[model samples]
Target: AVMDFACPGLMGDLTSFRKIYAAPIGKAGERGASEEEKRIGAARRAELGRLTQGFIHARKADEINASLLPPKTEYVVFIRLTPTQEDMYIRALKQKSLQSMLGRCGKSDAEAPTSVLGVIQNLQKLCNAASLVEASDEFDIDASSKL
Candidate 1:
Protein backbone atom coordinates (compact mmCIF):
# COMPACT_ATOMS: atom_id res chain seq x y z
CA ALA A 1 0.00 0.00 0.00
CA VAL A 2 1.18 3.50 -0.85
CA MET A 3 0.12 6.66 0.91
CA ASP A 4 0.62 10.02 -0.73
CA PHE A 5 -0.20 13.48 0.57
CA ALA A 6 -0.26 16.22 -2.03
CA CYS A 7 -1.83 19.64 -2.37
CA PRO A 8 -3.99 19.52 -5.49
CA GLY A 9 -2.98 23.06 -6.50
CA LEU A 10 0.75 22.30 -6.26
CA MET A 11 0.44 18.99 -8.12
CA GLY A 12 -0.37 20.94 -11.32
CA ASP A 13 -1.93 19.19 -14.33
CA LEU A 14 -1.64 15.42 -14.88
CA THR A 15 0.63 16.00 -17.88
CA SER A 16 3.09 17.97 -15.71
CA PHE A 17 2.98 15.23 -13.04
CA ARG A 18 3.57 12.53 -15.66
CA LYS A 19 6.61 14.44 -16.95
CA ILE A 20 8.03 14.76 -13.41
CA TYR A 21 7.36 11.06 -12.66
CA ALA A 22 8.77 10.01 -16.08
CA ALA A 23 5.61 7.94 -16.58
CA PRO A 24 4.78 6.38 -19.95
CA ILE A 25 1.50 8.25 -20.17
CA GLY A 26 0.98 9.86 -23.58
CA LYS A 27 -0.20 13.41 -24.05
CA ALA A 28 -3.99 13.61 -24.10
CA GLY A 29 -5.86 16.10 -26.37
CA GLU A 30 -2.53 17.75 -27.17
CA ARG A 31 -1.47 18.72 -30.69
CA GLY A 32 0.13 15.33 -31.47
CA ALA A 33 -2.08 12.99 -29.44
CA SER A 34 -3.91 10.49 -31.67
CA GLU A 35 -7.08 8.63 -30.67
CA GLU A 36 -5.05 5.59 -29.57
CA GLU A 37 -2.72 7.76 -27.43
CA LYS A 38 -5.67 9.48 -25.76
CA ARG A 39 -7.27 6.10 -25.04
CA ILE A 40 -3.99 4.78 -23.53
CA GLY A 41 -3.59 7.87 -21.32
CA ALA A 42 -7.22 7.62 -20.11
CA ALA A 43 -6.80 3.89 -19.34
CA ARG A 44 -3.58 4.55 -17.38
CA ARG A 45 -5.23 7.34 -15.34
CA ALA A 46 -8.21 5.09 -14.52
CA GLU A 47 -5.90 2.24 -13.52
CA LEU A 48 -3.88 4.53 -11.27
CA GLY A 49 -7.02 5.67 -9.42
CA ARG A 50 -8.34 2.08 -9.09
CA LEU A 51 -5.04 0.79 -7.65
CA THR A 52 -4.98 3.43 -4.91
CA GLN A 53 -6.68 2.24 -1.71
CA GLY A 54 -8.30 5.52 -0.75
CA PHE A 55 -7.87 9.28 -0.67
CA ILE A 56 -8.08 11.61 2.31
CA HIS A 57 -8.20 15.37 2.75
CA ALA A 58 -6.88 16.79 6.01
CA ARG A 59 -8.75 20.06 5.48
CA LYS A 60 -9.70 20.43 9.17
CA ALA A 61 -6.12 20.00 10.46
CA ASP A 62 -5.49 23.74 10.61
CA GLU A 63 -8.90 24.44 12.18
CA ILE A 64 -8.35 21.75 14.85
CA ASN A 65 -4.88 23.18 15.70
CA ALA A 66 -5.86 26.83 15.51
CA SER A 67 -4.89 27.47 19.14
CA LEU A 68 -1.33 26.28 18.49
CA LEU A 69 -0.86 28.46 15.42
CA PRO A 70 0.16 32.07 15.43
CA PRO A 71 -1.97 34.71 13.78
CA LYS A 72 -0.94 35.60 10.24
CA THR A 73 -0.45 39.19 9.13
CA GLU A 74 0.27 40.44 5.62
CA TYR A 75 1.37 43.95 4.73
CA VAL A 76 1.73 45.46 1.27
CA VAL A 77 3.78 48.63 0.93
CA PHE A 78 4.00 50.54 -2.35
CA ILE A 79 7.19 52.39 -3.31
CA ARG A 80 7.61 54.91 -6.09
CA LEU A 81 10.53 54.68 -8.54
CA THR A 82 13.57 56.93 -8.05
CA PRO A 83 14.19 59.70 -10.62
CA THR A 84 17.13 57.86 -12.28
CA GLN A 85 15.28 54.52 -12.21
CA GLU A 86 12.16 56.08 -13.73
CA ASP A 87 14.20 57.68 -16.53
CA MET A 88 15.99 54.39 -17.28
CA TYR A 89 12.68 52.48 -17.28
CA ILE A 90 11.08 54.92 -19.75
CA ARG A 91 14.15 54.81 -22.04
CA ALA A 92 14.22 50.97 -21.90
CA LEU A 93 10.56 50.76 -22.89
CA LYS A 94 11.16 53.07 -25.86
CA GLN A 95 14.26 51.18 -27.06
CA LYS A 96 13.96 49.43 -30.43
CA SER A 97 15.51 46.22 -29.06
CA LEU A 98 12.90 45.85 -26.31
CA GLN A 99 10.15 46.82 -28.73
CA SER A 100 11.33 44.15 -31.23
CA MET A 101 11.64 41.50 -28.55
CA LEU A 102 8.09 42.23 -27.40
CA GLY A 103 6.87 41.92 -31.03
CA ARG A 104 5.67 45.48 -31.02
CA CYS A 105 7.77 46.39 -34.10
CA GLY A 106 10.66 45.27 -36.34
CA LYS A 107 11.44 41.56 -36.94
CA SER A 108 10.21 39.81 -33.80
CA ASP A 109 10.77 36.30 -35.20
CA ALA A 110 14.46 37.07 -35.69
CA GLU A 111 14.89 37.13 -31.89
CA ALA A 112 15.11 33.76 -30.08
CA PRO A 113 12.90 32.89 -27.12
CA THR A 114 15.95 33.08 -24.83
CA SER A 115 16.60 36.63 -26.06
CA VAL A 116 13.02 37.60 -25.27
CA LEU A 117 13.31 36.01 -21.80
CA GLY A 118 16.60 37.84 -21.20
CA VAL A 119 14.94 41.15 -21.98
CA ILE A 120 12.14 40.36 -19.50
CA GLN A 121 14.73 39.38 -16.84
CA ASN A 122 16.61 42.62 -17.41
CA LEU A 123 13.35 44.58 -17.06
CA GLN A 124 12.66 42.80 -13.75
CA LYS A 125 16.19 43.59 -12.59
CA LEU A 126 15.64 47.21 -13.56
CA CYS A 127 12.59 47.28 -11.27
CA ASN A 128 14.64 45.98 -8.34
CA ALA A 129 17.68 48.22 -8.85
CA ALA A 130 18.95 50.35 -11.74
CA SER A 131 22.49 49.12 -10.96
CA LEU A 132 21.43 45.53 -11.46
CA VAL A 133 20.16 46.25 -14.98
CA GLU A 134 23.42 48.12 -15.73
CA ALA A 135 25.49 45.23 -14.24
CA SER A 136 27.69 47.81 -12.45
CA ASP A 137 30.10 46.76 -9.69
CA GLU A 138 29.36 49.85 -7.60
CA PHE A 139 25.80 49.74 -6.26
CA ASP A 140 24.39 52.89 -4.65
CA ILE A 141 22.01 51.60 -1.96
CA ASP A 142 20.25 54.96 -1.83
CA ALA A 143 19.40 54.71 -5.53
CA SER A 144 17.07 51.76 -4.84
CA SER A 145 13.60 53.01 -3.91
CA LYS A 146 12.53 49.68 -2.42
CA LEU A 147 15.58 49.60 -0.16
Candidate 2:
Protein backbone atom coordinates (compact mmCIF):
# COMPACT_ATOMS: atom_id res chain seq x y z
CA ALA A 1 0.00 0.00 0.00
CA VAL A 2 1.14 3.57 -0.67
CA MET A 3 2.24 5.33 2.48
CA ASP A 4 1.14 8.88 3.29
CA PHE A 5 -0.11 10.80 6.31
CA ALA A 6 -2.11 13.90 7.22
CA CYS A 7 -0.53 16.53 9.40
CA PRO A 8 -2.74 17.64 12.26
CA GLY A 9 -3.12 21.09 13.95
CA LEU A 10 -4.43 22.69 10.77
CA MET A 11 -6.47 25.24 12.72
CA GLY A 12 -5.27 25.18 16.32
CA ASP A 13 -4.66 23.24 19.65
CA LEU A 14 -0.96 22.51 18.96
CA THR A 15 -1.12 18.70 19.25
CA SER A 16 -2.72 15.58 17.80
CA PHE A 17 -5.72 17.25 16.12
CA ARG A 18 -7.52 15.07 13.55
CA LYS A 19 -6.74 15.95 9.95
CA ILE A 20 -9.45 17.66 7.92
CA TYR A 21 -7.69 17.11 4.62
CA ALA A 22 -5.02 14.84 3.17
CA ALA A 23 -3.29 14.17 -0.11
CA PRO A 24 -3.73 11.06 -2.21
CA ILE A 25 -1.18 8.80 -3.87
CA GLY A 26 -0.10 6.75 -6.90
CA LYS A 27 -2.57 5.44 -9.50
CA ALA A 28 -5.56 5.84 -7.21
CA GLY A 29 -4.52 9.44 -6.66
CA GLU A 30 -4.14 9.92 -10.39
CA ARG A 31 -7.70 8.79 -10.79
CA GLY A 32 -8.84 10.78 -7.76
CA ALA A 33 -7.14 14.17 -8.16
CA SER A 34 -7.27 16.44 -11.15
CA GLU A 35 -4.31 18.79 -11.90
CA GLU A 36 -5.87 21.65 -9.93
CA GLU A 37 -6.60 19.38 -6.96
CA LYS A 38 -2.99 18.20 -6.92
CA ARG A 39 -1.77 21.82 -7.10
CA ILE A 40 -4.02 22.83 -4.22
CA GLY A 41 -2.80 19.90 -2.15
CA ALA A 42 0.81 20.82 -2.86
CA ALA A 43 0.13 24.43 -1.89
CA ARG A 44 -1.48 23.36 1.36
CA ARG A 45 1.37 21.04 2.28
CA ALA A 46 3.86 23.79 1.46
CA GLU A 47 2.02 26.18 3.74
CA LEU A 48 2.19 23.66 6.59
CA GLY A 49 5.87 23.09 5.98
CA ARG A 50 6.50 26.83 6.07
CA LEU A 51 4.80 27.17 9.45
CA THR A 52 6.54 24.13 11.00
CA GLN A 53 9.88 25.54 9.91
CA GLY A 54 9.75 28.06 12.80
CA PHE A 55 9.53 31.84 13.01
CA ILE A 56 12.61 34.06 13.30
CA HIS A 57 10.97 36.65 15.57
CA ALA A 58 8.94 34.15 17.58
CA ARG A 59 10.64 34.96 20.89
CA LYS A 60 9.99 38.68 20.51
CA ALA A 61 6.40 38.03 19.47
CA ASP A 62 5.86 35.73 22.44
CA GLU A 63 7.39 38.26 24.84
CA ILE A 64 5.11 40.99 23.56
CA ASN A 65 2.05 38.77 23.74
CA ALA A 66 2.96 37.75 27.27
CA SER A 67 3.40 41.36 28.32
CA LEU A 68 -0.20 42.03 27.28
CA LEU A 69 -1.56 38.81 28.83
CA PRO A 70 -3.02 38.41 32.29
CA PRO A 71 -1.50 36.00 34.77
CA LYS A 72 -1.97 32.25 34.16
CA THR A 73 -3.95 32.85 31.00
CA GLU A 74 -3.61 30.14 28.38
CA TYR A 75 -3.58 31.65 24.92
CA VAL A 76 -2.16 29.81 21.99
CA VAL A 77 -2.76 30.04 18.25
CA PHE A 78 -2.09 26.72 16.59
CA ILE A 79 -2.33 27.54 12.91
CA ARG A 80 -0.93 25.21 10.28
CA LEU A 81 -0.48 27.86 7.57
CA THR A 82 1.97 30.44 6.26
CA PRO A 83 2.83 33.27 8.68
CA THR A 84 1.55 36.12 6.50
CA GLN A 85 -1.71 34.48 5.53
CA GLU A 86 -2.28 33.21 9.05
CA ASP A 87 -1.84 36.68 10.52
CA MET A 88 -4.12 38.19 7.91
CA TYR A 89 -6.78 35.53 8.40
CA ILE A 90 -6.78 35.91 12.19
CA ARG A 91 -6.82 39.71 11.96
CA ALA A 92 -9.79 39.53 9.61
CA LEU A 93 -11.67 37.10 11.87
CA LYS A 94 -10.97 39.18 15.00
CA GLN A 95 -12.04 42.36 13.23
CA LYS A 96 -15.25 40.74 12.05
CA SER A 97 -16.23 39.34 15.45
CA LEU A 98 -15.01 42.14 17.70
CA GLN A 99 -16.53 44.82 15.47
CA SER A 100 -19.92 43.16 15.79
CA MET A 101 -19.48 42.63 19.52
CA LEU A 102 -18.38 46.21 20.10
CA GLY A 103 -21.16 47.50 17.90
CA ARG A 104 -23.62 45.45 19.95
CA CYS A 105 -22.19 46.99 23.11
CA GLY A 106 -22.88 50.46 21.60
CA LYS A 107 -19.82 52.01 23.19
CA SER A 108 -17.34 53.47 20.71
CA ASP A 109 -14.48 53.16 23.12
CA ALA A 110 -12.64 49.83 23.38
CA GLU A 111 -13.04 48.71 26.96
CA ALA A 112 -10.20 47.16 28.92
CA PRO A 113 -11.18 43.50 28.64
CA THR A 114 -13.33 43.25 31.79
CA SER A 115 -13.66 39.53 31.34
CA VAL A 116 -10.71 37.89 29.68
CA LEU A 117 -12.23 34.54 30.54
CA GLY A 118 -15.45 35.46 28.80
CA VAL A 119 -13.51 36.63 25.76
CA ILE A 120 -11.72 33.33 25.66
CA GLN A 121 -14.97 31.43 25.94
CA ASN A 122 -16.51 33.41 23.11
CA LEU A 123 -13.40 32.89 21.00
CA GLN A 124 -13.45 29.17 21.68
CA LYS A 125 -17.03 29.00 20.44
CA LEU A 126 -16.07 31.11 17.42
CA CYS A 127 -13.13 28.90 16.52
CA ASN A 128 -14.66 25.53 17.22
CA ALA A 129 -18.09 25.58 15.61
CA ALA A 130 -18.65 22.11 17.11
CA SER A 131 -18.11 23.49 20.62
CA LEU A 132 -20.86 22.67 23.12
CA VAL A 133 -21.10 26.38 23.92
CA GLU A 134 -21.86 27.06 20.26
CA ALA A 135 -24.51 24.33 20.22
CA SER A 136 -26.03 25.76 23.39
CA ASP A 137 -26.64 29.23 21.92
CA GLU A 138 -30.40 29.31 22.35
CA PHE A 139 -30.72 32.72 20.72
CA ASP A 140 -28.85 31.64 17.59
CA ILE A 141 -30.86 28.44 17.18
CA ASP A 142 -34.13 30.28 17.74
CA ALA A 143 -33.14 32.95 15.24
CA SER A 144 -32.06 30.58 12.47
CA SER A 145 -34.72 30.14 9.78
CA LYS A 146 -33.71 26.55 8.93
CA LEU A 147 -33.76 25.43 12.53
Task: Score each candidate by Cα lDDT.
Answer: 0.69, 0.48
User: Candidate 1: RMSD over Cα atoms?
Assistant: 8.8
Give the TM-score of each candidate: 0.50, 0.21
Expressed as tens digits, the lDDT of each residue in 1-147 for candidate 2 is 011124343345423222423432232246666887777667666665565555323357668878997767578877444343345447645776565655556454455254444666655644444233334534444333345
Extract clashing residue pairs from model 2.
none
Query: Where in model 2 is the C-alpha error above 4 Å?
Result: 1-30, 55-147
Write down the RMSD of all candidates, one decimal each: 8.8, 23.3
Clashes of each: 0, 0
Compare the candidates by TM-score and give the number of the best one.
1
Clash pairs, model 1 backbone? none
Best by lDDT: 1
Write one digit per residue (lDDT tens) for candidate 1, span 42-120.
Answer: 7767765554435643457778678777887799987777887889989999998777667743455555577877877
What is candidate 1's CA lDDT for residue 79?
77
Candidate 1 local accuracy as lDDT? 0.69
Residue 91: error of model 2 in Å? 77
